[model samples]
Target: MRTALSMTLSSFGANRVDFASRIHEALSRVQRGDIDVVLSDLSLSHPFDGLRLLEELKTRNLLKQSAVFMIVTAEANAQTVLSAAELAPDDYLLKPFSGETLRQRLVKAVAKKQAFKVVDQAILQHDYLRALAECNARIEERDPYVIDFMRLKARLSLLTGAFLEARQTYEQVLRIRPAPWARMGLGKSLFRLKDYPNARRVFESVLAENPYAMEAYDGLAGCLEAQEDLLSAQEVLSRAAARSPAIIQRQRQLGELAQRNADWPVAVDAFRNTIEYARYSFQHDAGDYAQLSQSLLASGETQSAEQTLAQVRRAFHTPQSDLLAHVMEYGIASARGDAVRAGKSLQAAREQFAELKDNLPGTYSVALAEACYRAGDEQAGKEVVSSLLRNQHDDVAVLRKVEQMFVAVGRESEGKALIEDHANDVVELNNAAVRMAQAGDLEGAVHHFLSALAERPGSMPVALNAISAVLAYVGQHGWHDAYMQLAQDLLARVGAQDPTNGKYQKMMQAYRMVRQQFGIKGA
Candidate 1:
């Protein structure tokens, strides 16, 4: 295939073509030079494939706006195709194609890439509103790729949290043609709008047309989960995982859903797969080991659970991991009715928790709280959970998990009261700052939010509010470098934590516009 591609390109008067047989070599080559095209096969050496290469390029931002990536593979199964599509490859060519056919596909791919160059540039800059405007302008011009622009416009709308516009754009595309991607987009838009029943129907329709659509399955599962249909959601995710088992996030979600349903065996298998697959991906976390051990314990495999905890101690050397291992050990010891071991583990966990409480993730803190409750340290448990709530006051998922933990320990009412109190405190703090900003005391608002951030360093809402206050001050007063830098730092933190957040995207767009307005260069 390489020889054929080279010959075809050479025959077509190509300027130059570089080839690499391995993923690392390919990445190195791309890093060394500006390449216009990347051609890869789906299957490469074990554990390294075309998809991995694409992912690496994307992660490093190696692919320029106009660079075209084409995957030439003999594998045409639904899983392989959907997997490649998830990465949004420019083109997928099956093997045994003629030289002329390859040339045509390459021409079309390059053309499409060129057509969306402006929109892609804006998107690369995180100026999603500009990108959406570009898409709309291009669509109005009636370009040859109008459908592509329409699709992109719908996606940009979704990214900007313009769910109504996204729904309308997707509906327009579906009226033109019942494309599965458009249907999926429509479903996602509906889901965002909290129209779960309609979203479910749309996703179901997509699956009816193409049962192997992995994204459709995911969308359907999300809709079901939103409607509190845990069993149905778990089943949908199970089927999706069976089809595309390489997706670590899907496996992790499946495991969590199964764990929620108390399907210990399935949870064990899914978490095990998550751990294994995560080893090769960026989604790896020490929490995966903790989850697996919990599942093992629930399944009456205390020995395996202990081994899993031991593996965590070996696999990760962070304080968080140490704390997690001790917590899991306490659970294991309690399951075995070893009072002495349980007490020792609980003591170790408490010490670790005390040392790392300020920096620990909410999930780990929750685990520590549960261990504390089991050890009859109700005060310690309450204190840990309260701190976690303050840091993550706006995170509904974490709050739900904390409530569940309390309920498991027969403290549901107490948990509710604690959650409500913390939530109201955070709300009042935020509202006070917002009132300052509304009253034209922008500096005061910024200072208030900064103080809040110092107190609750891990609060996403506080971070976002601080950024807004800083930006508002900059916009109204002038470009204060310290305030701008502070906003940028907060944005970097938020981006690192949740890059896909719509609010973050909007904030980024606002940040860029502020810089541009102030004639700030080289940001």
Candidate 2:
């Protein structure tokens, strides 16, 4: 293969090397931007291939505008073409081609890369409009990059939230050629438009033609899940996992789906594989370890569950993981019919939980609630569940999970009634506070909100209201040190509990306004 490539490059008066064989050496040079025009086979000897190398290079910000990648392969099967298309190769050169053929292909590939350099530069600079315009100009000029740039314009449309335009471009591309990339883009655009049925069929067709297209599987899974087809969605992810087991997220999803199906054995296996494969990647999560322990206990392997919990404790030594290990212990003991140990674990965890000056994250709170319920400590469990409900009342997924946990512990009736009563208690407190503020009694409003916070310490809505009520009271009545401190602490909980919320950024600005008026430190 190298000899063939050498003969081709020599006749074209171009330098070449076998990047497939000397992958590490080539990648090292490529990383330093010392290599260009990578002519490579479909696959390399090692796990990382030419396609993967290009992916890694892009990840490292090394794939510059000058890079020209042309797939030189003897085999251009559906799988190969689909994989190559994903990387957006400049061109493909099949075997049995003469030196002149190789020269022509390389020239065309380089020219395409160079012509699209303006668009690439614009994209890198985050100028989607300019990139789209350049693509449009090329298409109008009938350039060789007509199809590629058309797809680029579609992708930019998708990125810029022009889903209808992207759908139109993808449809046009499909008419030109029955291509997987166009079909996948069509599925995505349709998914964005909330046309789940059409998107599902489009993705299914793509997968039918190329089963190795992971993106198609993901899109199809999304479509199924959007339509509430959990069983079929799980089947799709299961198929994807069979094809590629090393994806931690897919394994985790499969584990979650198996759990939803009450398939404990499959859940256990999926989570176990998640743990094993996660060791080789940077995407490892303590949740997978905790979940594996839960699955093991569910499968009646108490000893193995304990050992896995211990392993995670050693693996992650953070305060969060420390809390997680105790949560796992409670679940394990409860499952093994050791209520005494389970209760002891929850008691210890509660003490540690309360020792923190912040509210629990939703994920941590859910784990604790499950453990507390299993240990027959419904009081602590109720408090944790209340925290979650108060923090995210609008989240259907959270509501469903809360019900599932209660059902699992045989407390469905009690859980439903408790959530409703506690929810009403907080809502009444918040509503009264809002009423007081409306009537111009900021003092009374602040008091009511504080009372609500006392009941549901994780309530962001109440916390934000209390902060506002206090700010208004102070604006009229002058600053009280304790009131200011309360406002700051409430803001802190907003960060500790759910910093990912879009509200966090906006609320931070409000917090800063108060801080500046009082000449205090940052929020």
Candidate 3:
């Protein structure tokens, strides 16, 4: 205990307590966050005893909060240990423990806490970069607590949209400790990366460890959903929701899944529960309201759905915020068999979107398409779908809405052709370059990408890919200045287009890494 305290004193900068028999005075210092661990006698004569001290720390949510509450009592009974465990002190120390044992425990505790602290603070504040940096530092420490660090860091990485990094972190953590949380993280990361087979393996492994790991169940469902295995996804989420009845998010997700599957009753129940639980979070979107309205409409609850739409409008006033509400209002009007009101509502929604056409291509297309569909102008609906099909070649969300419109207008074949063509074009371009590169034809790959970019000048992915290939070629040919200048110009354009595009941001990072490695300078 002395060795641990001494190490804590040196490493974490905790103040030293006088070696006195009065444990309360020492614990008083511990409460001030000056100490990160408390090695105290179970019995104390102070107004607040050791158990009281533990409870106080837990309530304050301080650094010393449950920091290591060691009983240090010779009378270690099952009842006392059970009570201690219930209070959730990290580790319990028995009486007559050696200094080395104490040292190991404290070291492990400190390392785990230090590794987790950065992630905890980052999560508390939603600062992902600091969390990732801290995780990397902890990974370098090579301590036994590295798995915990990796698990936490993987979650942060996923939040920051660093799915590949999160996947690597989860893989490393699972190598050390095949815990349910780590496996869940791995599954989620792989799911994000669209690796369904591997993701399913990770999720199944999590269920193998803990069948009640509801999060893994949700992840497995998500993987199935991504693969368009909707039936399996529904079964997975339904089982999870049934097993763990308290997680509102899971229920909400299940509702969304059920809604997508057109299981209206289940969707309505899930969404209702979701709204009940998500009333306080900033993450609460009008999506639940919109989903509920749709589900209610599907269930023939016309009056309730209309009321929900009205409430959504009162809650969120912006056209963008209330787009779904307006759409739902149109749905309600349709349900009431009021063709005149339905046409008016759809027209108003279309106008609302048109005014912001430059900023909302998808919204404009969707609103106009819906307006035309209900107005019985099949030609106008076709035009709207065509416009969206042209402008939203790579956006899955927009494309899906377009597909929905296609189904509504009964132009299923045209819709299939349009979506498949755009997707295939992109896949072909990406695949050709990748194949050439793999076949040791780097120059040929660059040429093909450049020609493709010239043909489709505004294609961000293609343009960026061309630049990347050229940069690779230029680096090999010792044309550092030319490539660096081109990269700078391309990066500036990417920033102008959208500072949040992952491919562009990654290309920029690669440029920086290369420059740093080679000490390359711009001309």
lDDT of each: 0.82, 0.73, 0.65
Ordered by lDDT, highest first, the candidates read 1, 2, 3
Tell me which residue pairs clash in candidate 2: none
Stretches > 4 Å off in candidate 2: 1-146, 153-169, 351-362, 382-523
Residue-level lDDT of model 1, residues 164-201, one tens digit each, is 99999989998998777777889989998999999999
RMSD of each: 3.7, 8.6, 11.5
Clashes of 2: 0
> Any runs in candidate 1 off by more than 4 Å, and if so which?
1-65, 76-88, 98-100, 512-522
Worst 10 residues of 1 by lDDT: 78-87
Assess every candidate by TM-score.
0.87, 0.62, 0.59
Local error of candidate 3 at residue 159 (angstroms):
5.7
TM-score of 3: 0.59
Error of 3 at 126 (Å): 11
Candidate 1: residue 288 Cα off by (Å):
1.4
Give the alpha carbon lDDT tens digit for every residue of 289-357 in model 2: 887887877788889998998899878887777787888988888777887888777777787777542
Measured with C-alpha atoms, the lDDT of residue 321 in candidate 2 is 71
